[model samples]
Target: MTIRRTVKRVIDGDTFEVARKIQGTNRIRIAGLNAPDSNQKGYSEAKNRLRRLISSKQVTIVPVGRSYNRLVA
Candidate 1:
């Protein structure tokens, strides 16, 4: 299913939070993106880039699966 919502926060390079009416806040993981982890180099850069690209913007999500608490899309 395709879901459209405003991005509420950037969790990292490949994950972000979106507002949901019933769920409160939902975390989304960009499918196929292998961004660096917090301990790795370029982690901040990747996260900043992602944040700049989608911060406060309404984005379309097509969830493919779930990883922990995040919806992979």
Candidate 2:
């Protein structure tokens, strides 16, 4: 199912958190994105780009699966 929620936080380039009021989960992983890890080069740039794109914005989430505790979309 697809849902819309405001972006609460950007965890990294490919992962983020939505509003807590939504059901199921708030954490979400962007599917198919292989962004730089925390210790790697360009990590901050990638994360910041994502933050600029989605932070505090309402986004559509189409969940495909679950990884760790985050919903993959």
Candidate 3:
């Protein structure tokens, strides 16, 4: 099973950085819901929604590989 982590920051609707005291930085990108760029339409809203959805909460995280820092929710 994947380890659950507390959200540290919301990078976007599809991604957020997880805070941990490991040797390196860790970030997670949502599996689905490819949000547009910050300048794209509904970008802010989508990002906001994502933030609100997971802010200050714990979630499960399963790392796929080092090739990509993205993690599917």
Candidate 4:
């Protein structure tokens, strides 16, 4: 399913938060890839780049499923 919402936060390089009209907010993870963690050398750059790309913008999410609670898109 495709969902349209405003990106509220970037949790990391491949994960972010989205706020929806009725559903409140949900954390989402990009599928089929991995990025450096916060303690890793490239983490800051990766996250910063991702944040610049999507911060405060409306985005579409196509969820594949859930990992714990986060939607994998």
Candidate 5:
């Protein structure tokens, strides 16, 4: 399912939440970018950039348990 909403918050460099209810959820985490814990460089910026890419827009998620296994977008 695809949901439409704006970014409500940015957490770290790999997590963010959307505004309102989106398919009954709001969190979105990109799989490709991995960091060495919270102290990793550009961790926060990476997440912020991702938030900009997806926030307040329609997104279609093809859920994958091993989301980090692939490199497609």
Candidate 6:
């Protein structure tokens, strides 16, 4: 299913939060990509790239699976 929502926040490089109708505010991760953590090198670059890609944007989240509490999209 495709859910329409606004990007709420970027947690890191690979994870973000979205505000949706059915799920309210939830976290989602881009599958199959591992971006660096906060303490790692290239972390800023990765996060900045992701921010420039999706910040303040409306996105279509197609949920393929779930990992614990976060949805994988």
- Model number with the top lDDT: 1
Model 1 pairs in collision: none
User: Which candidate would rank higher by lDDT, 5 or 6?
Assistant: 6
lDDT-better candidate, 1 vs 4: 1
lDDT, residue 65, candidate 4: 89
Candidate 2 lDDT over residue span 1-73, tens digit each: 9989999899999999998673644899999998999999999999999999999999999999999999999
The residue-level lDDT of candidate 6 at 55 comes to 84
Give the candidate order by descending lDDT. Answer: 1, 2, 4, 6, 3, 5
TM-score of every candidate = 0.95, 0.92, 0.78, 0.91, 0.50, 0.88
Q: Kindly report the root-mean-square deviation of model 5 from the true structure over all alpha carbons.
A: 5.1
Q: Against the unseen true structure, what C-alpha lDDT does each candidate score? A: 0.96, 0.92, 0.76, 0.92, 0.55, 0.91
Error of 5 at 19 (Å): 6.2
**Candidates arranged by TM-score, highest first:** 1, 2, 4, 6, 3, 5
Writing each residue's lDDT as its tens digit, candidate 3 over 16-65 gives 87767674446787664589888899889988998999988987887654
Misplaced by over 4 Å in model 3 are 21-25, 66-73
Worst 10 residues of 6 by lDDT: 17-26
Candidate 4 has which clashing residue pairs, if any? Answer: none
Q: Which 10 consecutive positions of candidate 4 have the poorest summed lDDT?
A: 18-27
The root-mean-square deviation over C-alpha atoms between each candidate and the true structure, in angstroms, is 0.9, 1.9, 2.3, 1.2, 5.1, 1.6
- Model 1, range 1-73, lDDT digits (tens) per residue? 8999999999999999999967789999999999999999999999999999999999999989999888999
Candidate 5 whole-model C-alpha lDDT, 0 to 1: 0.55
Error of 4 at 43 (Å): 0.4
Measured by TM-score, the strongest candidate is 1
Runs of candidate 2 exceeding 4 Å displacement: 22-25
Q: How many residue pairs clash in each candidate?
A: 0, 0, 0, 0, 1, 0
Tell me how far candidate 3 lies from the true structure as C-alpha RMSD in angstroms.
2.3
After TM-score superposition, what is the CA distance of residue 52 in candidate 4 from its true location, in Å? 0.6
